[model samples]
Target: MSEIGITCTGAAVVNAIFNATGRRVRDLPITLHKLL
Candidate 1:
């Protein structure tokens, strides 16, 4: 159960990015171009 909160971490990050840039990133390893 070491990874139980892993999804929450990822979701939080994605949500923060979306809130800041108004973009929804569906892929892993968020990059510069993805936000641009």
Candidate 2:
């Protein structure tokens, strides 16, 4: 889903992804995060 884009629902977006998968975004890679 992130590959497409984040939804307008903020945390709900992460929650949806987490529900579908099994991982939580504890942290992002520094370089990738800094770019965003």
Candidate 3:
């Protein structure tokens, strides 16, 4: 994917996690520690 598309996908993943768990993650690569 293009750069913008990749960024959007990453943002979407972060948003999904926030919506599901009510946690705001501000890091890239979405580590397991961030999930917990």
Candidate 4:
């Protein structure tokens, strides 16, 4: 059997935001202000 690690919701959101806005965030806790 194979085991997988936990997924990071913050990373996913940051990636999505980066892809859409071309902004790379290197901070923790992705907030609405960061995205804007």
**lDDT leader:** 1
Better of 2 and 4 by lDDT: 4
Error at 25, model 4, angstroms: 0.7
Q: Which pairs of residues have clashing backbones in candidate 1?
A: none
Assess candidate 3 and give its lDDT. 0.88
Model 1 segments beyond 4 Å from truth? none
lDDT of 1 by residue, 1-36 (tens): 769888688889999999998999998789999888
lDDT of candidates 1 onward, in order: 0.90, 0.52, 0.88, 0.75
Q: What is the alpha-carbon lDDT for the whole of candidate 1?
A: 0.90
Q: Model 3, residue 30: what's the lDDT?
A: 90
lDDT of 4 by residue, 3-28 (tens): 23335666787788899889888897
Q: Could you give candidate 2's per-residue lDDT for residues 1-36 as a string of tens digits?
A: 774455445566556656866656544332434333
Give the 10-residue window scoring lowest on summed lDDT in candidate 2: 27-36
lDDT of 3 by residue, 1-36 (tens): 488887699889999999999999998879889888
Q: How would you order the candidates by lDDT, starting with the best?
A: 1, 3, 4, 2
What is the number of residue pairs that collide in model 3? 0
Give all TM-scores, in the order shown.
Answer: 0.76, 0.43, 0.72, 0.55
Clashes of 1: 0
> Which structure is stronger by TM-score: 3 or 4?
3
Off by over 4 Å in 4: 1-7, 31-36
Better of 2 and 3 by lDDT: 3
